[model samples]
Target: GPKVLQIPSHQIIDMGQMVTLNCDPVSNHLYFYWYKQILGQQMEFLVNFYNGKVMEKSKLFKDQFSVERPDGSYFTLKIQPTALEDSAVYFCASSVAGLSNERLFFGHGTKLSVL
Candidate 1:
């Protein structure tokens, strides 16, 4: 797997606050995704992006959550007025093509702790 870097390895925020998780995806990779893993739970897909649009997102992607990559900068996931349920480890992944190719590379993950 390619090495993807996630900034601020850990984050602690209170309920109803906002938090942004940043990912420096693989430079050559185009498609990007975000997955969440609660402690002791399975990793669940949240959203995927390509070009400049969100290709797909799971039901877990709440209305308060948004994803964007402006001017080819870092791919970011923003959660506003986050709930305690949002506390999880967010993993960023990227692939040159789509997930069908099975070439996804993942970051170490940003641990978000919502109190």
Candidate 2:
């Protein structure tokens, strides 16, 4: 199966620091997405990017969180000044659609613990 690969399954960071999560998706896929999930809570949409621009961003997307796909490569999320509430499992996903039509393929997820 062609699934997204999230590097470094777990991260422990201090409050008010920075961390980056990496995702490797299907080589030909164009759209990239990130979802955040906390224990006992439903997954919350974070951000979606396409064609080198951010298509949408949820309220959960904090100012400290940054996303990029440099050189059309890996989809990455960088969270600086991580807060305790930011400790959650981030699932990386990809779809082959532009706006109205899309199907998500989700990865296992990378768990981040901000202490």
Candidate 3:
């Protein structure tokens, strides 16, 4: 099954720094999503984008976090001034449409280590 692929596999950064994670999804995927998980914790949705706009974002998406696919290519998630609490595995996902029940193909995830 085709799935998303995240770049840099892992990232280590200092607090107050900025990091951008890139996600390469399948060619036909239309909806893009970002999720965050801290080690053993359950994954939480951060945001979803479609039609060149943000369809929804969770409280976890702070002011420092943003997402976009400028060239309709790889979807990207950027976080600036990252906090120590921001250390987590960020997963990128995609699906064909907005159907809630549709299964999303997820990337391996970018493990962010904030120090």
Best candidate (score: lDDT):
1
Clashes of each: 0, 1, 0
User: Candidate 2's residue-wise lDDT over 1-115, tens digit each?
Assistant: 7788998899888999999999997777889999999998999999999888888999999899999999977899999889999999999999877556667888889999999
Ranking by lDDT: 1, 3, 2
Which of the two, 1 or 2, has more lDDT?
Answer: 1
Model 1 lDDT tens row, 1-115: 4689999899999999999999999999899999999999999999999999999999999999999999999999999989999999999999998858467899999999999
Tens-digit lDDT track of model 3 for 1-115: 8968899899999999999999998889899999999999999999999988999999999999999998888899999989999999999999999697989999999999999
TM-score of 3: 0.96
Off by over 4 Å in 1: none
> Whole-model Cα lDDT per candidate?
0.95, 0.90, 0.94
Model 1 residue 50 lDDT score: 96
Give the poorly placed runs of model 2, Cα more than 4 Å off: 99-101
Model 2's alpha-carbon lDDT is 0.90
TM-score for all models, in order of appearance: 0.96, 0.94, 0.96
Give the lDDT of residue 39 in candidate 3.
95
